[model samples]
Target chain A: MSTSRSSASSKSGARQSKVTVNSQWKAYLQHHRVTAKDSLIRLLKSPGSSIMTWLVLGIALSLPMTLFVSLENVKQLSRVWDQSSQISVYLKKGVVPRLAQGLSDEIQALPQVTSAYYISPELALKEFSAATGLSDVVEGLESNPLPGVISVVPSLASQDAKAMEKLQDQLMHFVQVESVQLDLLWVKRLYQFMELGQRMVWALALLLGLAVLLIIGNTIRLSIENRRDEILVVKLVGGTDAFVRRPFLYTGIWFGLGGGLIAWFLLSLGLYWLSGPVEQLIGLYGSEFVLSGLGVKDSLLLICDGVVLGWLGAWLAVSRHLARINP
Target chain B: MAHVRFDNVSKSYPGGHHALSGVNFEINQGEIAFLTGHSGAGKSTLLKLIMLMEKATQGQVLVDGVNLSRLGNSQIPYHRRRVGVVFQNHQLLFDRSVFENVALPLRISGYSSRDLERRVRAALDKVGLLKKEKQSPIELSGGEQQRIGIARAVVNKPSLILADEPTGNLDPTLSAEIMRLFEQFNDVGVSVLIASHDLPLIDRLDHRVIGLKDGRLLNERPAGGL
Candidate 1:
């Protein structure tokens, strides 16, 4: 009976301590909410200069972001160029049109050729004359100088430079063929330039990311200076560094979110302004191409970049300056 | 029992400017004492040692029998929670209201909203400022601000109250009233230590007075020891 009684009393004591610990955690969470709201409100109360900060951050973030979007568009254009890669196989001078037609069928049956069409010399001459607005000049010629040609669209896998070159060599070896020309090398060069553009975008994004961090750091440094006396008072009254730091960190978050929102606005405006004209131009080419804006993934990544930079800047500022102010 | 003991503690800055040298004193539980000295006589240093704001260069400083030197950085806040401090400047956060100023310590100690309100109200009532809860610190007179600082200090019901020249900016009537407030706290088992240079006023009270001169203790009297 005595042991049971003592155990009951100890349990009550343990329960009391547990209640206090729970309250401690709940109160800390409460303070976190209050400070977060307080900081956001504080920023809102002083929006003139902070709006300027957000504007500057937005412009800096949107520049590299716009460049990246443009690079992606160029990449997409190169992909369209990749689709039209074809090889032209010209017949020898004395080769008959029937022989050229048979050769075209044979080339179409090859693994690398998706499709091939035979064009007689008369038809080729007519197409050239019509394309150049020189029908009278072409009709006055004594004989058709164009060769019978087999136009072969390569399979998707054979569109690359090395594969197309090999395919051209194989076609040139045909008995009736005089020459083979692949229309893909220019697209390959364009793709290389697109890759270089992507690299430049990444480099510019990195430099601008540093710029965002410096802006946040300088802003936070000013915040710390403005609250110097308040910090000293807090230090005197038993406030922990974390307790003091919570609000400033919240301020940094507000700045980041505000900047992110502004950047999103700017990017959307630019895309909206360009999408109509771009679609009209694409329509004029008789092709169906749709302009895409910032998708979900890219938008989230941009906001994440802003938040991470904001946090890094605030952490740097608080650690450097808070220690100098003693009670 | 001795609640605070400074065992020959000495403190010096990096430039070898000695703030406190070989000081020893103690304040027992349920006692009130005055620490009087000139401007540079180490009163603030002694208080800083209790708050663990600065470490002693040599010897030991103890609060409620715990060696302060052994108190790690993580434990410093909890240590401070148990010691009330009222500064001479009455460092009330002017950005907040009087109620918020008094509620700071309770908020730090993790009091629930109900408990925080009750304790803050009780503290303000102790200083007869419960009606002025909604006013700003700037809206109040100097004496009122000082009382607000005291309310903040005692709101947590700390075992020890350390006042650093708390009445230095107050008039004579206001100073005595502040002393009475400290006396009331001491009457209820809380130990109070006030640092002041008002020698004439301190002599009028029966509380013990510890005197420091040139970073050294001249007298170390206990409560009721005259």
Candidate 2:
């Protein structure tokens, strides 16, 4: 009975302390909320300085984002051309129609070659005469001079430059083939242009990311100087470094968030402004395509990037500057 | 048991300047004492040791039977919360009202909103500035600002109060009133230590006094004027 009573009292004591600690955490969170709000209000009290910071950050963030969007649009346009890769195989002179048809069958049998069509010399000459309207000149000739042709389409997977070049070389070595023309140089050029654009965008993003860090770091340093006296008083009153750092960090977050919103607004406005002209151009070409702006995912990513960079800059400043202050 | 005990305590600054050496004294619980000395006589350093502001270089400082030397950086704030401190400059934030200034310590100590209001009001009442809660400290007189600093120090119900020249800027009449307030707290079982060079004023009060000169302790008085 004595042990039971002691254990019961000890349990109650433990519970009481637990309750106190929980309340302490709650109170800390409450203070954090207040500090966040107060810091934002402090920023708002000086609107001119704060707006300049946001505008600088917004311009930095929007440049790379605009490049990325344009790169996406170009890629969308090139996708249609990727699907229509064709190769023209011209027959050697003195090749018979049956030999040409047989060679076309052999070309189509290759795994990388999707399909091949045979064009006899008779039909080729007749079509040429009709197209050129030169039947009198053709009738004056004694023998037909047109070569048999095989039109080949490569598989989607083998539509790259290296693969097409290799296939063309192999066809040139064929006994019945005289020349092979793979018109994929335009596709190759477009791909190179897209690659260069992507690399440039990444470089700009990195350079501008550093710019953002410097901006936030400088702002926080000034803020620390402005509140030097207040910081000393807080420290003298038993406030820990973490406690004193809470408000400045919140200020940095607000700045980053505001910059992100500005960038998003500017991006959407630019896209809206361009959409009308782009739609008319698309209609002039009788295209059914629509201009797609940044989706929900990209916008969220942009904002998250701003927030992280802002946080990192503020953390760097606080850790460096706050420790130097002594009460 | 003594509320504060210094056992051969010594302090030296970074440049080998000896601030205090071989200082020894003890103030029992519920006692009021004055630390008097000339400028740069280690009076401030001695009080700072008790508050754990400056670590002792040679010996131990025991406050409420806890060795101050054992405290780490994380523990310093908690240690300070138990000891109230009033400054001569009354470093109150001008942006806040008088009530907010006094309520700061309590808020930092994690008091709930409901308890915070009552405790802040009670502290203001004790300082006899209950009517000026909403007024800014800038509008108040010098003595009132000093009292607001005192209220902020004591709002957490600390068992020890350390005042470093708390009334240095106030007149003799106001200084006496501040001393009476410290005495009231001492009567209620709080140890109060005041460091000041105001010999004429401190000598008029009936309390134990410790004197220091050039980093050495002179002697300790039991219960009398210096």
Candidate 3:
């Protein structure tokens, strides 16, 4: 009977300890809830200040994000252009059409050559006349000024700039070949310009990002100053720095989140506004390419960036100013 | 043991204005004392030292047996949890309701939700402002706001309570009522230190009065009855 009684007491003690642990957890959660509620209320109290912070952050975040998206678009276009780098080798003026066709076949036989096109001097002249709308002028000439040409479209694996240049040098060494032209200068210039633009965009984004941080930091500093008396009272009433800082941190997060949402909205509006004109211009070029705005992944990244910036700005403000406001 | 003590404590501002000079005093557990002086006499500075809001430029402040000067930044919060404080202007958050304002300490100390609700209601009841729990501090009168401050201070059941001119903004009748509240808390074994310039109120309270003059201890007088 004594053994049973002891065992029963042990069980009851275990239950009591379990209850105590549960109560402690409940208390901790309650404390966090109270802090969160207070923070939200504090942010909602001053709508003017909150809106001002959100707008400043939104504008700052949008500039970098928009530039990044444009850079990505340019990169995509360049990748497509880079893949189309091919070389055209023209034969000598006196070369016969049959000889040019034989030369084209011989070039195709080379391991590096993907495909070759044989165009006779007459056909080349005809194509030129049709394209340039100067058939009479060309017809009156004693002989066709154009030469027979072999257009070589390299394999996708050998389409790099260096590989194409090397192949052009090889074609120039051909006895019957007059000249080899790749005509990729415009594409190369476009690629280089895009690289420069990417760097400029990043530099501008960084400067503007710093400006955003300062704007947020200053706003939070002002907020702390305005609530100087309240902070003093809180500290006097046994409130810790963490307790005093919780609301301000939440305010910063809200500003960041709101700014992110606003930036995303503005970007979508800009894209929508520009879509009509962009489509019209594309139609004029007889192409079906459409201007793409931020995609799902990019949009999510933009929002996260905004929130991070907001949080960082708030952290700077709170850490610096909260120390100065003693009870 | 001394519930609160200041040993040779001095505070000098950046421009070299000494707020307190070589002040030494101790308040035993459950004692009630009034810290009295004119404006700029360092009464507030003394209270601040106990709260760990400001470090003494020289010497030590021990509260509940912990030397505050030796405490690290993170340890200050735990030390503050053991004390309650009321301010002159009440400094109640205007955005919060009276109940939420009074519940600040309890929330900081991390009470259970049910316990916080019960303790907050009890504190408001004790301050005779339970009916005003739903009202905002901005809507309450100065006296009511002061009561709310008192409620907030005592809600955590701290061992020591400090008041810096808590009744400075209230009229005579309200000030007397507030003093009575402090006295009641002392009767329940909480050490109380109040800084005030109201001689008549200190005289009526019959507690020990520590007087300060020009940042120095002038006199220590025990109330006539006590």
List each candidate's DockQ score: 0.25, 0.24, 0.19
lDDT (C-alpha) at residue B49 in model 3: 88
lDDT at residue A205 of model 3 (Cα atoms): 85
Worst 10 residues of 2 chain B by lDDT: B217-226
Residue B221, model 1: Cα distance from true site in angstroms: 2.8
For each of the candidates, the C-alpha root-mean-square deviation to the true structure, in angstroms, is: 5.7, 5.7, 7.2
- What CA RMSD would candidate 1 show? 5.7
How many clashes in candidate 2?
0
Which residue pairs overlap in candidate 2's backbone?
none
Candidate 2 per-residue lDDT, tens place, A172-269, comes to 98988988887878978987888899999999999998899889989998998888887887777777778889888988888888888788889999
Instruction: For candidate 1, write residues B98-207 as lDDT tens digits.
Output: 99999987776677888889889999999999999999999999999999999999888776889998888889999999989998877666777899999878978867
Query: Residue A17 error for model 2, in Å?
Result: 11
CA lDDT of A14 in candidate 3?
32
Per-candidate clash tally: 0, 0, 0
Q: In angstroms, how far off is B84's CA in candidate 2?
A: 1.5
CAPRI quality band, candidate 3: incorrect
